[model samples]
Structure formats: structure tokens, C-alpha cells
Target: MRKHLSRVLLVLTIGMCCSISCKKDTLNINYGAITEDLSAYLYAYTSGMISKASPIQIRFAQSVVEEAKIGSVATNVIRFSPSINGEAVWEDTQTLRFNPSDYLKSKTTYIGTLNLAENFFQYP
Candidate 1:
């Protein structure tokens, strides 16, 4: 009887310990907050089969400065200012809309780069 009582108490203690230490907890993820030690970058975007005669829209993953200079390089290896008369609108805190004065050339491959100001990445 004594041996049985000790075994039962040991099992109960282990069960209690497992319940206290092995339970899964939920994680709350804040998508907008940039944690420390992460390198911030501008993610360029494109949609499939954009109409050449219509205006082009570019999106980013993070909020950038309103005065960001957008540059593009065509397949000819020549870089030109494609974003003319464009305004950077923070549709949300994380999106940018660029409206160019002219439409993009059809069937042309263009690589874009967003020039962000230094202060955009600085943390207080």
C-alpha cells in the first residue's frame, strides 16, 4: 500500500509538471512592427499582363518616404526615369501608388529600384 501511494504521487507530480511546462501558448504577431535585428528593404511589385496604355501601379511592403525616387532599367541596359509626375500615396501605412505621366512600353522588361532616404530606416 505504501509503495502504491508513492507511485501515484510521483505520477501526479509529473502530470502536474507537464501540464504547467508543456502546454502550448499562442503567439500574437504584429505584422506592422519591425523588430530589432531585421534588415528593412523595399519590395517592388508587379501585376501580370498590365495594360501598356494605362497607368502603372507599384506597391511596396513597407511605408516609404513620399519623395522616393523611382528608377527603372529596360532590357537595353539603359536606366531612365520611368516614374514621371508620380505621387507616392500611402494607401495604407505599407503601400505606395505611383502614377506616371505616360504609359509603359509594351512587352518590355523593366527592373525597378526604389531610392529610400536614409532616415526612412532609422529607428528612434
Candidate 2:
């Protein structure tokens, strides 16, 4: 009788294990895309007046501009002021160029501006 009882308990345990193993597990997953806006800036230093034509390269810094239009791009525009006393100087917009070495200047402190436009991505 004791042996029979032990066999019945072993059968019940095996049945329970098989039932749990037959159950299926459910899983959920989601995916999407992400994008970031781009931006640009300008930089430069001061040198005394120049006697002959001298090239002054403007420096650029890291900047970010969001919500850019799809087609519009960013361009750096540089302006210059030539004054001996650093006062009462004239201002003019130079042509757009990737490198600052393309421009020339006489006695002046140069300022640079980066003109950026938004393309397709819009800011939230």
C-alpha cells in the first residue's frame, strides 16, 4: 500500500510539471524612429590694422538650431569694422564661404554671423 501511494504522488508531480511546461508565454514589442535638429555658429579674433591686403579667417563654434525647414541650409555671414581706436568703425557683409581665408581686411575688428534656416523638421 505504501509503494502504491508513493507511485501515485510521483505521477501527480510529473503531470503538474508537464502542464506548466505546455503553457505558452506572451510577449509585446514596439519600435519607432527619432531625429534631431542641426545648427551652426561663428568665431574670430582681433588683429591691428593691415598695411597691405591680409587674409583673416573667422572661427566657428558648435551650435544647434531646431525646427529647420526641409530645403533651407545654414550659412555663415561675416561682417567687418575697420577703426583704429576700436570706435566708429564701418560694417559690411562679406560673401558666404566655407573657409574664412577667402576674405581680406584692412585695420578692423571682424564679426561673424551664421545665417541658418529650418528645413523639414519642426521644433516641438
Candidate 3:
């Protein structure tokens, strides 16, 4: 009986020691508040036909609001510049759309920058 009790106690002690010594790694991901500047791209499209005098339409994906003083605000700020020697063209505007009559170019690349801001709960 003594030996049996001793063996049971020893096994229990070993199990307790192993359980206490065991360690596990945990990963914590925080979806905290993030703030940064972002830019987007806009492309001009035309039919299958190619010509130097062909009209191009400027199109952008979607605009997001990064910051607003009052209600929700969504707009695009863009600028336009001419492209030469296969170089990229620059376009800037706070509005979303522009007309071909506003600028004249052929076989050019246009650049666009999109600024988005939103408000979320910030823990104190």
C-alpha cells in the first residue's frame, strides 16, 4: 500500500510539473487606427482604332474620404501635364472628370493621386 501511494504521488507530481513547465506562444493582432497618404491611377481609353487626333476619356476607379470637417466628403484632386518622348503625363484636379478639350495629347500616360480619409473610434 505504501509503495502504491508513493508511485501515485510521484506520477501526479510529474504530471503537475510538466503541465506547469509547458509554454505556448500567442499572437496578438491589433487593428488600431491608421493614418497615411495614398495615391491612385487613372487611365485614358479609346476604341481599337489608333490615331494622333483620337479623343481620350479620363477615368478613375473610386474615391474614398480620408478626412472631413462636416459630413462625408468624396472627391478627386488631379492635375494634368503633357507627355513627350514617351514620358508620363501629369494631371491634377479636385474634381473627378475632365474633358479632352481641356488638354491635347496623343499616346501619353497620365498620373493621378488619390487622398482618402476616414474617422474611426480611437481608444483613450
Candidate 4:
């Protein structure tokens, strides 16, 4: 009787696993698009001190706008620019890169902003 019970449980578990894994993959295809009026926000890395010469790369949880739009908006808020103009590079679909014209000051805490609002940094 014990052996029969174990066999029944095994069969039930196998059936459950098969059913769960049989679902389709809908990522980036037929997952259905969602539209909203959300705006882009800033995200900063604060694990350690950022290098003075390192180019600031901005990433987003979701696609907000084109690379040019991020650069244009960032330029108006980011006040750490050595020059008025810096190169904005988009490396991936959700990442925007900016090479500062000057090195960041050492031991000085810098805050990032989005549309003149603060509290945009997060750790994940």
C-alpha cells in the first residue's frame, strides 16, 4: 500500500510540473503593450564613490523616451557639467551615457535631479 501511494504522489507531481511548464513565452511579443503618461526619472549608483572621470550612465526600469530626449532633459537638470555641452551616448535600448567634460570633485557629495525634483536614486 505504501509503495502504491508513493507512486500515485509521483505521478501527480509530474503532471503538475508538466502543466506549469507548458505555458507559452510572451516576452516582447504578444505580451500586449501598455501606454501611460509617466515621465523619465534619474537613477544613481551610490555603492561607493563615483570616479571623477567616469561617464555617467543612466538606466531606466522601462523605456521612457529616445536617447536624445533623456540627454536634453538631463542637461537641464544635471549641474555637474564642466562645459555646457557633453557627449550623450546610447549603448543599449534602456541605457543613456554621458561623458562629463570635467572630473567630479573628490569627497564632494553630488545629488542627481529629474525636472528639478529630488529623491530619484535607488539601489537594486
- Residues 1-55, candidate 3, lDDT per residue (tens digit)? 3443333223222221101111242223221111111112222222222233333
Q: Any runs in candidate 2 off by more than 4 Å, and if so which?
A: 1-46, 61-76, 81-124
Better of 1 and 2 by lDDT: 1
* Per-model TM-score on C-alpha atoms: 0.38, 0.21, 0.22, 0.40
- Tens-place lDDT per residue, model 2, 1-124, is 3443333223222221111111243222121111121112223222233222333332223222332322232332223322111111112121122223333332223332222222111212
Instruction: Report, for every candidate in turn, its global Cα lDDT versus the true structure.
Output: 0.34, 0.25, 0.26, 0.36
Q: How many clashing residue pairs appear in each of the predictions shown?
A: 0, 9, 15, 0
Please estimate how well model 3 matches the true structure, expressed as its whole-model Cα lDDT.
Answer: 0.26
Over 4 Å off in model 3, which ranges? 1-76, 81-95, 116-124
**Clashes by residue pair, model 2:** 43-59, 49-107, 68-118, 68-119, 69-118, 69-119, 69-120, 70-119, 70-120
Give me the overall lDDT of model 4. 0.36
Error of 2 at 67 (Å): 23
Candidate 3 is scored at a TM of 0.22
Q: What are the per-residue Cα lDDT tens digits for candidate 1 across 3-35?
A: 433332232222211111122442232222222
Q: Which residue window of length 10 is worst by lDDT in model 4?
A: 14-23
What alpha-carbon RMSD in Å does predicted model 1 have with respect to the real structure? 23.4
lDDT by residue (1-124, candidate 4, tens digit) is 3443333223222221111112242112121111221122212222223455666554544554554444343434333322324555545545556665665555433333222232122211
RMSD of each: 23.4, 33.0, 27.9, 21.6
